[model samples]
Target: MSDTPCRVAVCWLLPELEQPARDLAARLQLPVATADSIEAELLLRLGGDGLSLQATGADAPGAVRVDFVEGALAHRRQFGGGAGQMVAKAVGLRGAVRPTVLDATAGLGRDAFVLASLGCEVTLIERQPIIAALLEDGLQRAREAGGEVAEIAERMTLIQGDAITFMAQWAAAAPQVIHLDPMFPHREKSALVKKEMRLFRPLAGDDLDAPALLAAAWALASHRVAVKRPRKAPSIDGPPPSAQLSGQSSRYDIYGKKKLG
Candidate 1:
């Protein structure tokens, strides 16, 4: 994991969210500040819309946050092929059964939400406190939106903790499929850089511990462990994957003790 310090604070951008912002600050042990008064380079902003992770440097990319209610997620749900999506197929969502999934490194929850929308009981584990806070805010917003979004949120359980520990503790009752997308080392920054990746790289560095994490998931996953990686990137050191499905930009290294029926 990257050893970078969190250069961020909780900022309340609206009067109504001030208390929630302050409460979040206290929970995160981060000082509360305003856009004008804050010294941190990034802000966990509580605004009229919802909580957003704001990049504050002169040339920084735009703010990034989880929004499963509308926007890209909605478009994906409406237009994107249902069980034919790469992630959906990777987690064995093709047949009649929608396997229970544990998304161990659920950074922004995009894939997990898709799985949940496709009818999987998904447990999301995020280790970073700030990211977890953002996810919680988004989930709360989606739940209150009260429609299909709320129903999807009902199928997702968020755990703000380490995936390995949780896997070990819940080994006997492991989910059918464990999905992992540990932070892969990225290419050089460019105009097309994934905004979320750029913002998250500093907070949660390269997944140097990815191999260990894969081992834990492999030990506990009842059906299989699906690992997402850069298409050309070599698999992290582990028992060789039973199969791999490659796409233009990414690949799924699938490991399983027994095949899902």
Candidate 2:
């Protein structure tokens, strides 16, 4: 009965381990609906240590299923060095700056995970409660995913609030670089995009207000702000990028500001 339309329906696929789940849900401010057929905008699978989610399309926020933390850790390892460079670009907003990072739009938390993997303390800010719940569940799983990098995954922090609000409160520690990866509408709707993007599109909706997000990020980022856009698409507001990293279909626009020591 909250303003948020998406309801997190955790069907008991496994036995109930209520404390951690409930505690995590509370921490993330996600709505834990008791009814089985409450017409959830999203359906979340609450495991012992993590969560998996699929947008039900009625009112879900984004379509992403983060395997438990260990699963995520494996995925991170597989993502390999390309992801490492993405994290580097994020870190480089400060130009050799190793300042704390605030990932303003943490979709599936992939970028945040990468930043943490690269040894940067990451604070993830997500507005939607359901998405935050999935992230929390994923983080918990990552903690259990034992390997050389488990400790680095543990360094991530989740804050259940609007990025703008969090940035305002922590103005003093304004992140050296604020990373923004707002969801863009799929341009060429084909089987590939559908297979890969259908679920996420309904869940995240179109971030029509991405420009506002850019403005807020600029205000909060101390050294610079980097936005990931489809290679075909233009820059967020203008073409003032200090540098551009292009891929097959996406690009990273780095907007550098102050210099770092």
Best by lDDT: 1
lDDT of each: 0.88, 0.67
Worst 10 residues of 1 by lDDT: 185-194
lDDT of 2: 0.67
Per residue, candidate 1 scores C-alpha lDDT tens digits across 150-238 of: 99999999999888888878834679999999987765743338788778888988888899899999988899999998888899898
Count of clashing residue pairs in every prediction: 0, 8
Error in Å for residue 15 of model 1: 1.7
Q: Clash pairs of candidate 1?
A: none
Off by over 4 Å in 2: 1-8, 17-41, 55-64, 68-75, 82-84, 93-97, 187-196
> Against the true structure, candidate 1 has what lDDT?
0.88
